[model samples]
Target chain A: MIKFLESIGTNILSWIKITQGFLSLVGQTFYWIFFGFRKKRPLKQEPILDQMVFMGARSIIIVFFVTFFTGIVLAMQSAQQLSKLGGTIYVASLVSISICRELGPVLTALVIAGRIGAAITAEIGSMQVNEQIEALDTMAINPVRFLVVPKVVALFFMLPCLTVIGDLSGMLGGYIIGVNNLGINSHLYIQTAFEYLTLKDIYTGLSKSLVFALIIAFVGCYQGLNTRGGAVGVGRATTISVVTSFILIIVADCFVTGIYYFTNL
Target chain B: MREHKVAISVQNLVKFFDGRKVLDGISLEVYQGETFVIMGGSGCGKSTLLRHMTGAMKPESGKIFFGDKDLTTLNSDETEAVKRRFGMCFQSAALLDYLNVEENVSLPLREHTTLDPKIIRILVKMKLNLVGLSGFENLMPSMLSGGMKKRVGLARAISMDPEAVFYDEPTAGLDPIVCAVVDKLILDLNKKLLLTSVVVTHNMESVFRIADRVAMLHKGRVLQIGTPEEIKNSQDPIVQQFINGRLEGPINFAENIDDVNFAGEG
Candidate 1:
């Protein structure tokens, strides 16, 4: 019983240490973001642009395909139920509101969490293990400002942009299904989707994406910078970064959604 | 003999990792314009001492003075100001894989100075030429062999014309011929540039060939510090065992020995 208690205590301490370290990393990132411009050598613009192209532009096709297909599936499922109740026209309201307010942002974040989060961890973890990060430091370069800032800035702008694209693709997919397959009038389906999707819903999804962007960048860079034990350690860090980003995205989605729900009430 | 001036001095330095002392009460001085080598077995805190000296790692209780300024007491910006005068070559070369050779060598210049692109290119070429890699400017780090990578790392290290260069096991994995070449390059560069050098290596041949003075670290303490000849003639059993590769001495190798039977499997 004593041994088990000790094990549990150790586990709890480990968790606390990890949480503290993670919070410290997040705090440092924000500090650098707000004050880094005042430094004698401001953050460079070229790397930020490069990262924007790499993380944002490269991800559009995948986000479009996934969200489009998701919309199709959602429309088909909802149409079957609504048609049973002689209310097939209501499919527009269901698909538009759900896709615009929830699925668009949430699914885009999950996909990016897997794709970009893993890549960031792997790249930075490899640099950490191989001492490239230290090399940067020896040359008087702030690794956070040089590396993490560009990634965070890029993702901050791109996640929302990608979410917007995903929203449009999803709505288009729903339109195809509602008008062609469900036998709903094309004009009525389009009008209903636009009418129900308030600017509030669109902005809420975009705002959630922004928070998700921060979570993904912070977690990925944190896991990466702390990686040790060489190649195997980098692989582990990458996996952990993706998993943590996924969990945080879902949790953050819930909290943010809850805030919006209660605030509007 | 040249009159000695202290370039770096460490006083009563102590460091602990995981509740175990990795550097214990270490004190030493590296003279200006001489190659100071720290020699020790693996895990004897040679690299740790180097890290501390370079301001890469902080000691628990100690002072590191680079010239008159105390390194441990400096703020981040001040420390970076001090570090700009120093160059370090990691054991694995640690080249940024995304960059080509010329870009890698030109990184410090680009980050620290606003030199003309033409001048940066010229300086890159000169540094690469010094390392015998002039024509290999555009090659990626992945394309280079182990020896080439180390040479490229050296090229990058010296690209800034630093006052001192710290090498961490520069010849760790190279063949004997390549190791000799690297040693010769270190000697030539030290003499030509008059740059202070601090190297951490266990390669006995490297120590004798390149080190102006050798500091032997044993179990996180300075076992001995002397010239190569003095170290060779010293009476310390541990030093003798390490320098001579002896099996029996105060140093224990039994824990690392395997118990496999080499005879017929009776």
Candidate 2:
């Protein structure tokens, strides 16, 4: 029907509008980071440091736990199949390579998307509803410079760092399973985990995490700054932020992995 | 009375929300060193008009001038420069809840100036003292009572010694005694700091207590503009309905309640 087509058209138009809004927000955040201080005031270091501690330092344990358990599961699943081929020792290599190339970065990002991403949305959404953001605007304070920049910068550097920790913890988990449960020699397991795991796997995972960091920060902040209503609005924004970040993280992971696959890297 | 110079002028400002005319051909002026109150029922576009004047919201048509500068055409930097000349206090007090009182008051000075920290501290103390909140500097906004929060908000508003301060329902939710105290503070600040004040409120008591002039808006249009006494004696039925807090007359309650819900959508 004509009405159905019209509704579809309206949905597409709203999708385009939202995309434009999101890009503009990301653009403004970058502009503030690069050139805002030169023209106006330099951003204070204190807020950025505070954000780094919260987003990076505090997230280490959760990232470790998630990736570590994932490594154990991946090892257990692979060991069952490899034992049939009489290559049960291959469990160490399989766990290390998969964890470093995929699970470590992806799991860490998903966990952070839920944790810090939700927090970012909640904090900024509350500020938006309470009119503190407008208060800053009336005071000639750029909210992007005052708020988003610190968060973006913190996560930009911190997500990779967290990914590194995730990678190590996951490898440790694999080592424990391969040596103790799988009956593989401890020394041989260590050697096998490193032998097939090239520098490419580590760098690829870290690079993917870098991109994921931008996705999480941008989605969280966009949802936050656009939030209306009051407490309910904040809750809605947080949920949407987390969901959007999760989808984007998976989609981005696919694209990045595809790039490496196609380019034969 | 001596001739007064205009501090802010809005000419034929129009705005729409969800295709509804929320601010329609509104015009007004606030004079320097005087308390000009915009009084109206909820959803009458008084707050929207104040937002335009503060340059927080843009109008679809017409110009807003602060002294000689037109607000609509300014670049971001120019707009920021213009904003630095005035202050706004929100209905919720809108203090940065993360910051302590002294830090909140000193935010502007720290961000905008190269002043010594000691000097900024002294200025914060003085501004807080002016609002009778000197000793409450270390307390967070959450620790303050409603009246004290409003006072802290007022202190933050005048922290930069702005030429004008716009108050959005400064006494919206408070005991009547506290409301009177806030009104008195507005009067004292006007006299003491020689600052222009534009207040938007529906509270008739505060309007008479502090206003040098009053503009009553009804359904996105100015119903009447006059001194408090003239407004009190206005012949317009809508104005009479508003000033007397009556449920009957030209203003419709069901319609306004609908407008309130619609306003939320935009």
User: Tens digits of per-residue lDDT for model 1 on A206-261?
Assistant: 99999999999989999999898789999999999999999999999999999999
Docking tier of model 1: it is medium
Cα lDDT of model 2 by residue, B123-236, tens digit: 999998899887888999999999998898898899889999999999999999999999999999999999999999999999999999999998899989999999988899
- For every model in order, the TM-score on chain A comes to 0.96, 0.97
Off by over 4 Å in 1: A1-5, B255-266
Q: TM-score of chain B, candidate 2? A: 0.98
**TM accuracy, model 1:** 0.96
User: What is the model-wide C-alpha lDDT for candidate 1?
Assistant: 0.90
Residue B71 miss distance in model 2 (angstroms):
0.5
DockQ of each: 0.74, 0.92
**Clashing residue pairs found in predicted model 1:** none
Interface RMSD of 2: 0.4
Residues A75-133, model 2: lDDT tens digits = 88898999999999999999999989999999999999999999999999999999999
Q: Clashing pairs in model 2?
A: none
